[model samples]
Target: MTTPTHAHGHGHSHGHGIAPVSGRSLVTRLRSLMPLLGEHRRLIVVAYLAGVLHQLLLLTSSGIGAYVVARAAGGASLDQLTGWLIALGCLIVPLVVMSVADSTSAHVAAFRALADTRAKVFAAFERLSPGYMLERRSGDLGSAAVSDVEQIELFFAHTLSPLAVASTVPVATTVALCWFDWRLACVLVPVLLLLASVPAWLRRQAELHGHELRDSLGRMSADSTDTFQGLRELVNFGAHAQRLGLLRGQGARLAKAKSGHGRRGGIEYVATDTIALLGILAVLVLGARLVIAGDLDRSLFPVAVVLAAMAMLPVLKVTEVARELSMVASSADRITTLLDTPAPVSDLVSRAPAGPVVPHVRFDDVTFSYRGDQRPAVREVGFEIRPGETVALVGRSGAGKSTCANLLLRFWDVTAGSVSVGGHDVRDFPQEDLRRLMTLVPQDTFLFNTSLRDNIRLGRADASDDEVEAAARAAQAHEFIAALPEGYDTVAGELGALMSGGQRQRIAIARALLKDAPILVMDEAVSNLDAASEQAVGQAMEEARHGRTTLVIAHRLSTIRTADRIVVIVDGHVAETGTHEELLAAGGAYVELLASQLEGFVERAS
Candidate 1:
């Protein structure tokens, strides 16, 4: 009703229209989060240190166990055995303290950081152009806002501290092993090195499958959202099987991507387990040889083998965690890409006068196109609506009717030329300042899932109950609202209100009337109504237009018969303009359209 989705096309399916965007590095993606994470940076650092220290304590406790074994095997005194055993138990309290500190700090910082990131993402969406939101799939965007952010949480909560510990604790343990017998450290070093190499060797594969998994997941979510939102339509048309088939297609793609990602992870998991096992075996053989050759004390042989395994333990954990980073990295890529999406680039001038204002609206050779569209939706077309006049715009569907209203409201900037209000370019006013002077009643009204009273109040938040009721009465929405169970307070929206199409139109008209803006743009407001309701609401609309500049985007000729002037648009350009009788007398594009409608009417009657 506002311009069709495009000037030429009817609509697009969910998964087919996802535009390609440049991928970003994980570190580069993380830079957007620096401001949000700055608050908790200290806590994150503390968490890392706590995790490493806890791991060190565990390794130390293991070493004490090995030391007690060696002393017992050497036939040490009972007091010596008791002292070493007691040392291991003393390590317990600090271990408990460090574990609690690590888990608490990591999760607290991670959750708070995630909360901040989610808010920023929503805020970015708020600041973007309304047109941008309409162009994207709601479900795909929802996945980014909800699911993608959830994936990033894995890195901070479960993976991050472990990654830090892997980097640090293994090196500390390896140094300790070197002190025991440098030969033991030698065998563990190659195992740690090989396990660490797994991630780097498969880096390309990780990135490839990560993107696949994320993209397919978004596609499936979008398909599901589209299906659910249009479930009623699908069922009414008896197309349930068709919708199910599309959903299955989306599911199949997602499954394929998941399988690829899992296969990559499996490789990393196998490499880690294999390398660790080999290191343990090699240490056992070497330690046995050293004891037999009498080059090492028999009591220290088993201790050295245990130390060799402990040193390689952290590296094995590192590789295990690395496998999951594929998802985290991909999620980060999507989020940052969203943040980087360019908002409509423009400058709004502050020179326009403030306060309640609506002047003559003029389009001076206005040319515009939606992003990604080749040809302009409206091109080099000019028109004017003088203050306090009622003008009707009539055209075949997709003739840029609603686009004109979008321009006046500054939902988008013109590609070339200018649209002006009060003889100043529309961009001369801040978006908020410009929108305050006009109201657009779209064909499809979106009501929030809230009370009916609250929905009406959205037009003018400060309007009183009396004023609201007056507006509702003017739009003829009052009678039906009063008949409802809760009257004006009845809950309304997706599942609430149980409203008819005509009834919803009346509510929208009421909302526009409440705003009381000086300029009103109504797009087929009465199109959904039956003849009886249409006549009543038409009278209300007629009265509402008095003393205001009104632009009616009409498809039905009967609706605009009372309009003072009519402008005929053809393929985004104005073809004719005059009073209804004057246009009919001219016998131009207007007459051709009128004749076609008359022929259709006669056919329907027959």
Candidate 2:
């Protein structure tokens, strides 16, 4: 069975643009979060309604106070005053209740939305290509995932419900004031509109500075993380002071950026407050004149003044959250960018292929390039491995050996041609199914910060303790593991820092052994091992290779001598292919590589 040529183009479109995400308008970017808001619509609606009720209670209290003052001055009965006081006292309990309910509901909804957003972001990270992730700084990505996502909570909790109250409360208060005197309502409406426009006028400046602040903070985070991860290297090279200086420089820039944005926000706050105060003052002066000229009733003058103050509260609320909205807009933009990015490899085929697992692999006229590279990393590369054969790929660094392995794993699709397994295009199988058929032991084994037993069990999650121990014995790791204080229960620490390089490599081999996939790819599997450990690992590989396909990527000649065939890769092309001795006898690239290694060894010895 052979895959048809058209299978290569089944779900991929070469004509689609593969550019980085572009910046969008603030409104458009923030609107992307509506789906998250819609998820908890009931909580949002309850919070908004509570906010409205809370504002209305305040307005009613103000109106009742105005009536009591007017009636007392006009010599009303003590009975009327007592009745008014009772009504005012009665509003307090529900007022406090509504206010608390509003705050609690909004905050709960915000946190829930945040949780969903982070989950989706994590899922997006999982779907994106490893190559794409490698191009970015891990710390910067962390900032987007953790810090940027946190910033959005302010918008959800404070801005969303308050925006609803701001829209409705002012109009309701204005209508109530009109029932007292149309003249006072006329004076306050235009002033309220001016207060609301203050934030809009400052929006562009806020957006510009907010974006700058977020970017500077992200850069600072990346720099700090990189410095810490490489602290050991810096100290060994006596470059700690220089690296510290660079870190301080990042900190200084971050401080400067934050200060600039803070200064502008402070100024906007002051301006909005001044406008709100002046609006209240205008209502007072205008209402007093109307009362004296006999155009307004004296008793209702205080009512108009108090209502005007109540009306401006919503506008003030809007202004208070306007700065936060600007800041959240920047955060929302970053998250949108991450979510919008296209996955480098699409898993279009969902079903597992129906056939026996042959373990044969083939690369047909494959070409690939890194995202920003001018030249292809691997050009017109092709290879074939028969069932149960062991093939070694020998090459210098950047010779596209690892790229070939990546293509086989379908970490990336071939830029041209196809990589097929068992006569089916790798793309025809789901990514999980394709990967399940093979196992990889990378040069730098990444052990989780977990027990030694659990790290080995990662390859086969359901493997029993006995099965795990058996795999460890096959890789010659059971001895060292058993010698530890807690044996298999010992923690590996970060990246297996608690263990020696050779021990880590053996554990990785044990993991691959436990997986027991039909196709095994070992990338410099013995490069970190000492002579004794290498011998043990070599025996393990020999035992594991029986009746299975194996691909070994190595620069060490001794490691490949036992391979059935050796293919020397030069400058992304297959330069020679034959048995180990045959390649050396041919006096080609493989022999030259061997000579170079020998020359280096001799030089170091001298």
Candidate 3:
């Protein structure tokens, strides 16, 4: 049961700061997108073939114009010109048809690849430890899931086709020009390079700006979530104005960053325009010179210049799209890191075979600590709970009571020692099977924004409606639920905001009863209830504990007075273990805790 620690990648620091996700070089970023295409190999083949054919049709269109001008320059007949026009129509129609079909195929293949990649990303995270997941931000993780995978779509839909087309178009265009005259092809090559370089510079600036933008957006989302969750606190303290000012400041920073990138992007567009115009001018002047010198046919020169000029479309388009795609690739890297996160310890042990039910649990010399802390939360702690016994763990706030609850549930493994249930090491039990044997009513009860019946049914998804009501009755929640506007159908509204604390606690207890696990852990379930409600819930808890190995964590002395045994914990170790009267008579940690609560109880009663 030793909880393992993983060494993060070399650049990862142990400090309490968020580090940028690492391990993606330019090559890996490109490779990650390649797998998506490989996954749909057949579709990719068909799509690329369509793209190449589409480019060829375009090449043919340009060739038709070249033939028309060359024929006219040689003083050919009007009848021949009319025949050339008809051939031009044939080339133009296929050019349009194949281009449309190519786009359609790319889109279909891109979406299917995206779907497969998304499923794998989510599945990988699902296999990681819950403890590791809780440490990350919900908003940041949300951005990774929705926004990150979307970026890869550009790789399939646009990047792939443009790459294939750019490669073929320039090569084919260059060869045709070379056949006419090498000087024209030579002049055009440099122009394409200059135009492509402009966007590369723009993309470098964009990558830096994009990183800042993503960070600001993540902070904005985190702050927004915090504000909504703490609305009551903010209103009560009149802190809304200050929080709003902070949000506005972050928004302004993001806008400034975006506008700066936009300005640089405009400069890039102007650069591309200059390059294109220069290439056209060079081709025109050279073609005219060749015609006057009688080194080229007058009609062929115009047609050659036009064909060379059109070839810039795919090259220039690829450069521009590649720049925008770097931002998309940023999202891809973040998502890939999350999906690639390795589990700290591999679950290699096969599940113990299920046989006789053993309700007993034993912790032998257990030790545990949180991820970064130097001090252990629970150290050298050992105990045993026999079948059908009710044991209460009583402690001050940081005495590791909840840590013990987490240990029993196997939310994390111990740093050292063994924890076993029913004579099987907890680690040897399948996670799902181990969970099936235990149920918990946490200190802070959470009910989904759903009906009372549906909320209770979460304990056992397959439980019948009648079985649900029976469990509710046992938890003393049936009467109040029946009196509600819609009875069991009443909406709980975000974490049971529609119900009182006592009502939520009852619902949680009902869930535990419905689960009907042999081992139950109730952590301060009645702590927030008023005296009358506490009395009601405590009675329900007592009923629920019958014939089960129950472990209750309580702050209130009265709640554990009837517990078969009470263990007092102090500074991660059990200081005393005995009946309530025995511990009180012993006059140690229990005596001090009881005295503090007695004063509060007297004040409330008065």
TM-score of 3: 0.90
Better of 2 and 3 by TM-score: 2
Between candidates 1 and 3, the one scoring higher on TM-score is 1
Model 3 lowest lDDT segment of ten: 8-17
Candidate 3 lDDT, 273-294, residue by residue in tens: 8888899899899888888888
lDDT of 1 by residue, 480-579 (tens): 9999889998878664336776777777888889998888899888777778878777877876788888899986776788788898888988999999
Segments of candidate 1 deviating more than 4 angstroms: 1-36, 295-303, 345-356, 372-374, 462-464, 493-497
lDDT by candidate, in order shown: 0.78, 0.83, 0.78
Ranking of all candidate structures by their TM-score, best first:
2, 1, 3
Q: List runs of model 2 lying over 4 Å from the truth.
A: 1-23, 73-75, 528-533, 543-546
**How many steric overlaps does candidate 1 have?**
1
Which portions of model 3 show Cα errors greater than 4 Å?
1-24, 36-38, 65-78, 92-97, 202-204, 344-346, 598-606
lDDT of 1: 0.78
RMSD of 1: 3.4
Clashing pairs in 1: 2-402
Model 1, residue 544: distance off in Å is 3.8
